[model samples]
Structures are given as C-alpha cells and as structure tokens.
Target: MVAILGCCDSTNPVRRDGGLPGSVPAPSPGALRAEDQLPRQRRSLTSEDRSAIAVGVTCGCSYAQIGAMIGRDKSVVCREVTRNRGPDGSYWAPVAHRAAHERRRRPKPVKLAANPGLCRRIEVAMDEGWSPGLIAAMLRHEHPGTSAAARMGRVSHETIYQALYVQTRGNLRADLHRQLSLKRSARKSRGSTGRGGSHTYDHALTISQRPAQVADRAVPGHWEGDLILGRGNRSAIGTLVERSTRFVILLHLPGRRHDAPSVAQAMITEMSKLPAHLRRSITWDRGSELADYVDIQLNLQAPVYFCDPHSPWQRGSNENTNRLLRFWFEKGTDLSTHTPDDLARIAATLNARPRPTLDLKTPTQALHELLANPPAA
Candidate 1:
C-alpha cells in the first residue's frame, strides 16, 4: 500500500481505517455537522454553541477550551456564561439560551411592569410631585445593593420618564403622569423665552458682589427667592429655596398683595422662624416685588443679593422651585384662594420631596441635618 503525503487528493492524510491521524475526521458527504449549520459570521451565539458550552462547563473545561469547541473567542464564551447564568450561579444551557432570546426580543417586558414593587415606589414618588429624575435618584439612593430587585429598582431617570411619557413602556399608573411637576401628557421643549424687564437696582448688591461661599452652596444658609405670578400678574406666591439644601418656603402673598412690602414681610415672617445660621444670605431677581429687599435684610439679618437683569439662571435653585410650585398653584389662577395654611401645606410637600441635587435627600431632611449640625459661618 502506498502512503499519500500532502497530495491534493489526500490533503487531510487519513490512516488506513479512514480516520485523520492528528485532526478531526472529515464528515461524511451525506452527514450534517454542527459547525456547518452555523453562519460563517455570526453576530450572536447559537443553540449549538450554547449546548457545547454547557457540556464544556459541566466537564470543567476552561473558557478558552469551551470557546474553541464552539468556534468563538474566549471572551465571548466568558460573557455568555457570566450574563446568562442562573440565580444559583449555575450556567444551564437551555435557561441561558432562553434568557438570551428574551433579551434579543424587541420591546422586551418593561422593567417597571415585571417589578410591581418598583412601580409602586415610582408611582408614590410621582404622586408626591417628584420629578422623574428625583424619583429615579431616590430609588437608587435607597436601594444601593446588588440584589436582583435592587438592581431592578435602579432604573435610569429616563426609564421612569418613559414609563410616564411613553404609553407602552411601563406599568406605572395611568394618571401618574398628571402627578408630575409639569402635569403634561407629553414632554415639551424645555426653555424660557420670556425676558425679565430691565430694572436698575442702583443701591442693591448684585450677585457679582455675593460671597464665593454663597455661589458654591458650601455653607448651608444661602437662599434664592422669586415670585410665581398668578392670573394677569395680579396675584402671586413667593418661593424661597435654600441654595444648599433646596429647602422650600412658600410665601402666601394673598389678595394680590405681592407688592414690595407684602413680599418682604412674608419672606421675613417665614424665614425668621429659622435659626440665624440657617438664614445666611438671600439672592433675588430684579422683580419689583422684591423692591423692599432692604426690609428683608434688616429683619432676617441676612443680606439680600440681586441677580443681574434678565438672568434667571443666576438664581437657579429658586427658578427651579418656582416651576415646581406651579404644579400646585397654576398660572392664571387666583393665588389668594390658597390661604396661609394651604401655602404651608404646599411648602411642606415641596420641602418633603426629594431633590436630585441634595443626593436624593428631601430638602427637609437636608435642612434638619444642617440645623442639627449648624455649619460654621
């Protein structure tokens, strides 16, 4: 018998019995092979590959060995095993494969749907007039763990928003969107085009002269104040947000008495209830309602600072709080209808809502901590 070596006809070089000496034997012409069915360039793992991986894992083969058996990179094998493993830390081929399919399916179940506990928490927060971002942050803040449900609870802010705005994404309550600060059925472009009327506060201290500490919000007492006007600008509510804690205090400027004296007195009465340390500085826009800022400074003993004309962003915390207050006190409504007690309740509700800026702590909690510790001047 002649031995064939490296000839085109005997490229695979088999023994007399027809088995390749040092390599896998060629499949029979009519026989199907596992590798033959796999696409030449597969984007994802196939059932056959998963089956091979399962067998390899059961036999204690290394990831590289398993990948070699399945014609995939070692990292690919590693990721597949790591991600699709069962809860008990076992990698079952069938379960993993099913999970992979579920993941690949378009419009997979909404996280908030499968997780009712998470949905309830989200709904409660939304109902409390919390922003989606705030609710998301608070969820993450409270559930800082690696458990399955904890992981589910850590949905992104955009996810909570989609649950509210996108009809099909989550199991959140239908009316929960109305509980949002904006109370809008759909999102709108976020911007403000209304310009503040130019006013000269010749004797007022501009935000430029404000201390560096106030701008950075390092010390706990600095505040930002503004008036959210009602119908025809006849009635208004004064809003004060602590720059550090975002703690809100709503002034009941009832009977359309949002004049300079009324606003100043309302602010003084509400803010004076705090310890002097918690009443450090006040920053305001150039609104005429705050014309008697001097009286506020004298009574509260906190110097009032003014933002530059037409620059609402300068008092960002206050601007944001005003927008939130609008949820309870809508524009074009009679502000006087909400009495002092009503205003107090609304303010309490707002201060109780968690703020994203305050590390998911409610402004009330942050303020309490500040009061308890009382940061130095």
Candidate 2:
C-alpha cells in the first residue's frame, strides 16, 4: 500500500503481484531547500522564557503568550488548558502542562474553540432573553479569569454574531441563531424623500436649508424631535433632544392619535417652556403628526425644518434620544400609561446620566453650562 505524504488514506490496499515496491521517496532539492530555509525551532524553554510565561499566566497572561512559549498556536494551548485544568475554574501551570502533553499525543478538533461552555452559557442566557452585549459583560464579570483571557475560551459579542451569520463555521447549534433580534439578511434601505417633498405644513423649511450653525451643532438652540410608538400603534410618546447638549424632553401623548393638531400643540407647549434663545429651530421627519408644522412654527416662533421622508439620520439627535428612551419606555408597551409628569421624570433621569460623548458630563450639567454662558450673538 502506497501512503501519500500529507494526504489521508482511508481505504485498505490489497497486495498485488508484480507491483513496484511502495517505498518512501527522498525529498527533492526544492523541498530540501524549503525545509532548510525555514526558521530553526527552539528545542527547549529557557529559564527566562519559563519565568515570563509563569508570570504572565499568574498575572492573567492570555493563552497567546503560553502558546508562544511552547511553540504552539494559542487556540491549541487554550484547549489543552481548558480541557485538562479546572474546567470549573482558573488555569494552573502543572495541570496545564500535563494537559498539553496529553493533548499533543491525541488532538481533538474543537466545535467552538472560544469557550464552548461560555458559548453554551451565552446561548442559554439569550434563550432567557438577554442581549448579546449583556451576555458578554456578564461573562467577563462572572467568570473573570477564563472568560477574560483565552483564544479558545473567550469571545466578544461581535464574534457571537459573526458565528451565527457566517455559514462556514458549521452551525453547531442552530438554536443559538434564533436569539438574534434581527435575522441575518441584507437590509433594504428606506427610499430618500426629496428635499422638496410634501411637508408637515405649507412653506415649511427643509433640513437642507437649516442654518450652518444648526448643522454644525455648535449652537444650543437647535433641536431634533421624533415619536416612539407603543403596542397596536394606539399609544406613543413624543421625544425631543437638544443636539448640542443632548438634553432630552419627553411628551405624553394620551392616545396614539398623533394628528397634526395634537403634535403641533405638543411641540408648541414644549417649545414654549424654553426661553426664546433656546428655541432656534426644530427638525422632524415627515410623520403625519407634523402636518400642522406651520402652526407649530407660528405658535412657537421657532422655524420647523423637515427631514427627508424615511430619513431618520436627518434628525440624529432625536434618533439617539429615542434609543435612550427605549431603556425606560420599552417597545410594545402601553405608552399612554405614563402622564406628562411621568414622562418629565423619565427625561430628567436620562439627562442626569453621564454621557461619554459629553466628556462624561451629565446632559443636565452640559445643558446648564450652555445656558449659564449662552453663545454670543
């Protein structure tokens, strides 16, 4: 039987009479040169190397360093340690060394190299309705040692997502795919509404025509607004935010009936609360609620700029504000349960949370600072 180099032989070959002997072939000159050109492998670990690896492992060195010392890949080292050492806890050198030696003799392919257990745990958590981000954070917190350091035992939330979407990984557990909020598929972008499309009201200004200062968000008076719908589209809350300060304001829409009159009234009432200096312009999408936008502009004395239809990014501040609002006013709930006062309290809470974008300052502090020393005319 002739055995091919670097190739698998699955069938047993029967002896044939008068056949050439299946002798191993000598290396060709090219192969010899290739082998000679390769870098020399270190035969034994130096004291310094061992010390460094020991220190690293003790001080939470990643599996990568351990593998480098042993002349193996990081995932191989991780699997050896995870499979041999305390599967329940942290890695110890003696146990890890023994595991590595045993694994070298009989290697096993990993289904999910980065934390098979952790991945399973994450799947369980997702089944229980936890988000991927939340699961990642919890793993880092709960299993600090193994979950935080490893090529085979630790993975980011993004990795979890990629594994689910990318087909090459071989779906080990298809059930895990169900945990994703959005199914894996190309998303259809919304069509752009023209700059001159129908407006919430006659003679309304388009976002493109808004002042340069508003676009730059250097001025504190520029505001963006939107609505979040509740279950059955019968309940909703109006959300507005100051672009510069991220200051949030929420309005309780008693019923989901966001008609022109009701929406315009809400805008007027909210804008009326701010001083004239803080009411420069308002940006909104082409929702029917803003049909009476002319009334809002006239009553509030602030220009109303309409975003192109289906373009949520046009009112970025309001879009971001709505995301934060979701933390409190979740989707598919009866938003009408909250009163104007309740909505005000929710807005106040959000304004008090520190924002990294705002130099870790709470929106309240940022807004107060802006109001304290108003930008020069």
lDDT for each candidate structure: 0.77, 0.66
Instruction: Give the clashing pairs for model 2.
Output: 114-152, 115-152, 115-153
Please provide, for model 1 over 264-341, each residue's C-alpha lDDT reduced to its tens digit, 9 standing for 90 to 100.
888888898999988889998887778788888888999999887677889988887888787788877888788889
How far off is model 1, as Cα RMSD? 12.8
lDDT (0-100) at residue 340 of candidate 1?
Answer: 87
Top-TM-score structure, candidate number: 2
Model 1 scores what on Cα lDDT? 0.77
Model 2 residue 235 CA deviation in Å: 0.8
- List the pairs of residues colliding in candidate 1: none
lDDT of 2 at 178: 59
